[model samples]
Target: MTQPYVVRYVGGPLDGRVDSLPATPEVPRQVVTYVHLHAGPKIVHIYELSYAVEYGCEYVLRVEDE
Candidate 1:
């Protein structure tokens, strides 16, 4: 079985959220998609796996022009 590790989101709407996920091959980035309202267009937030700490890792939100 794979060990589960904690991932902390550093910015954007999901800031401060912590998730326990299985340890897998590290990816360069993570993507989050959400809609503001029932009729609103979907928004994509990109995050990069920035660094690691004693317990797990941190994903920092990436800012870019759409």
Candidate 2:
């Protein structure tokens, strides 16, 4: 079956080099397990080389609710 999700190009700038699984509105920060980037019948798949998350400053401020 065709996948219900799709990857879109969101052009912007990050503080440093950043690369990870394709993200969607529902799964923000979700590391992608696989992807198909080619158009039409052809397809491509990509998997994570690493799983990562930030645990400092930004994450610290949000911990008060916990």
Give the winner by TM-score.
1
Q: List the residue pairs that clash in candidate 1.
A: none
For each candidate, the alpha-carbon lDDT, in order, equals 0.69, 0.29
- Off by more than 4 A, model 2: 1-39, 55-66
Clashing pairs in 2: none
Q: Model 2, 1-66: lDDT tens per residue?
A: 433323332221211333333332453433332333455674433222222343111101111235
Which candidate should be chosen as best, given lDDT against the real structure? 1
TM-score of each: 0.61, 0.19
Per-residue lDDT of candidate 1, residues 28-49 (tens digit):
3455443344466767777777
Q: Candidate 2 clash total?
A: 0
C-alpha RMSD of candidate 1 = 3.5
